[model samples]
Target: MSTAPLPDLVKTVIVPARPDRAFAVFVEEVGAWWPLAGFSVGGASSSVAFERDPDGRATHLVETLADRGTAVWGAVTRWDPPHALAFTWHPGERADAATRVEVTFTPDGDATAVVLTHSGWEARADGEGARTRYDTGWELVLKPFAEHAGSSR
Candidate 1:
């Protein structure tokens, strides 16, 4: 396999909600919309959630397996409500091999434009392969998030 550095994978989705509401739903209600069955480190029956600190700040993203075990996907790197959220991403791998995912919510008229940028691929042993999988994976993961966020009041 070639050792070329992969470009950042950027995906954008327009959600029918204000930036504040959109960001809230994305971070707080992620477990409801995230497609755990296909995207989880654990099996199909797993559930994902953001673990918040005592002050209600998100500190880490975790997936709970069917057998009651847990896998820490990543730690929160940036958390600005209604605007941006960023974290390290290494679902089944070591934290040292984690990539970075930064998502921004921009107000667009009556809706919000949510942009996700996945970078830092070179940290992983299979950076190119992982980037390829996540390119398509983010599409599937975001579809449900858009739908669920749109329907939320």
Candidate 2:
């Protein structure tokens, strides 16, 4: 196989909210909008959240299994509200094999343009295959987030 790096997966969505609100909904209310049943290590009944520090800053993302066990999806590397958030992603895998994901929110008139970029695929053994899956996976994952972000809270 070739040793070339895989291309980054980029997806964007426009939500009917300001940048701040869009960012908040994406991070704070992820458990409600994330399609856990389809895209989780812990099955449908599992819940996911950004675990916070004592000062309320998100430190990592964790998935609480149906059996009360937990799987750490990733650790927060960058957290800038209403603008950007990034982390090392390796759900159901070891941290040493983690890839990177970065999301940015920009104001677009009355809406917010949310952009998600998943990269660092070369770190995984199945980098190309995983990238191919996530190429479409993000669409399924972000649909609910866009809808929920537009809905009244």
Candidate 3:
């Protein structure tokens, strides 16, 4: 048993694009930007998608396998356009077994300050390890998002 407290991971990047564009590229084009090689439940070659409904509602973030099967990585809990998005994040795990990930796109002059905060690890059984892992994990995941946001502008 460990007495280490669960931690909240926060990472921020200044995207060259505006707030709306940064948010758009981050949420809408996730399949193109998210690195699937090392971070997917669909294995190394899997493709990921941030699926949204016709009504501007985010449905699921899923990973598609080479064999065409799918893994539900998370569900969108908040979908505020061009500003903020919050979701449950626990790929290949039960829906209830999830942590909360919230990202905010703040307008910073001509650029957007994209802040990502992952929390709720206190509820996880593997709290300490998971907290430490995602401390590094989000940096890997969001690196491409920053690049894409810059390039798409």
Candidate 4:
């Protein structure tokens, strides 16, 4: 018997942009699409940064209302342009217990299909919840990406 759930960690969306453009938005323009209300920093993030090199850092910096508290989120596991991006998602939770998020982009005609797989939650007690969160998160992320891509053309 398998302890894993029915659906694996993969969530895919087809965007109306080439692989490079789609990849750039995820790395460069993430702050524009990231939902401030859902951030783990307990504040609205001022800037989101993603380092492209392997083992690089993907950081989300947010400032609290009191101006006395500032928080940063994320860790990078893999970075491959126009192909895949993988990182750790800790937000407000324990960084060590965070799950891994892998996103891949494959060319599909004039568009690119984005496949996001957030796994490594198999060991967490709240794996089901985490999966549910990502399931919705992908929709949030992809919707704006698609809209933005459509407008650009």
Candidate 5:
């Protein structure tokens, strides 16, 4: 008998803007809408940012809290504009144990369909719980994303 593959956790939303615009809001202005307090490494109030290295060698998605300083949530794996973005997500864990999160933007007339998939949980010990946690967490991220990205139009 063959074991089935692990299921990916997914969240999809439709933003009231073009794909490029939705992409910009997600990448360029993540700090504006990302809920930094309850959803970050610090577990307190903080700011989230997608900071690209000036030397073009690295990009970090980090959480910055007043007392906790900065925490690395992930590193950028793909940066395809207005289409797809993928990253390694290892918040509060070793880099070697990181999972992958991929978000894609599809254009639908003036609106944009945003689909986010977080996979590779088989690497973690608490993969099942993590997946459940992210199911709600990702929804939190998407609500603000849709609102913020929509208003930018």
Candidate 6:
């Protein structure tokens, strides 16, 4: 049997929005904060949609120079409003493998602390590459989200 390493990444951010509002924006306004340039299923991701229901799907749609791509990242495994959102995460070639992602929003006085954990990756040939991509991706995406929340405050 082939053996490969599993992928994992984590990121955190503090946003000015309250916990409830921050959580809402994360699920509802994903298109505004997701950095979909190099990490998209295709070229440019047109939208990132999250369905809140248990087992609901999270999809990313993209359009390239000559082709379009759509990918189902995973289903919602846990959904606790204003506190936690957990789901499976897999991208492109790693689709068959499963991973878990948890985003927690904690009340920090008036602001919110957003902590993200990406783990449970099944070791595969490209697992390390996926980990690397997510490392940079989370930073990129969270930066904008934090800024957006801060500006609106």
lDDT of each: 0.93, 0.93, 0.84, 0.68, 0.85, 0.70
- Lowest summed lDDT across 10 adjacent residues in model 4 is found at 57-66
* lDDT (10s digit) by residue, model 2, range 1-153: 226798889999999999999999988999999999899998899999999999877899999998999999999999898799999999999999999999999999999999999999988988999999999999999999999999944
Candidate 6: C-alpha lDDT: 0.70
- The per-prediction CA RMSD against the true structure, in angstroms, equals 1.5, 1.3, 1.9, 3.9, 2.9, 3.8
The alpha-carbon lDDT assigned to residue 15 of candidate 5 equals 96
Worst ten in a row by lDDT for model 2:
1-10
Collision count of model 6: 0
lDDT of 6 by residue, 1-153 (tens): 125535457798999999988987787777676666755665453556674435543333222322344567676777788799887776564545766789999999989999999876454455666677778878887898888777765
Model 6 CA deviation exceeding 4 Å by range:
1-8, 52-69
In the range 1-153, model 5's lDDT, one tens digit per residue, is: 112335999899999999989998998889888876767777647778888878643387888877868888899999888799999999888887788999999998889999999998887777878888999999997998899999877
Which stretch of 10 consecutive residues in model 3 shows the poorest summed lDDT? 1-10
lDDT of 4 by residue, 1-153 (tens): 125853567777888889989887777777666665554365454445554445444443332333455443557667678788877776667666667778898999999999888777764667887788778777876787677765665
**Residue 38 alpha-carbon offset, candidate 1, angstroms:** 0.5
TM-score per candidate? 0.95, 0.97, 0.92, 0.77, 0.90, 0.78
User: Would you list the clashing residue pairs of candidate 3?
Assistant: none
User: What ranking emerges by lDDT with the best candidate at the front?
Assistant: 2, 1, 5, 3, 6, 4
Higher-ranked by lDDT: 4 or 5: 5
- In candidate 3 the C-alpha lDDT for residue 105 amounts to 94
What local lDDT score does residue 59 receive in model 3, on the 0 to 100 scale? 76
The true-versus-predicted C-alpha distance at residue 102 of model 6, in Å, is 0.5
Ranking by TM-score: 2, 1, 3, 5, 6, 4
Model 5, TM vs. native: 0.90
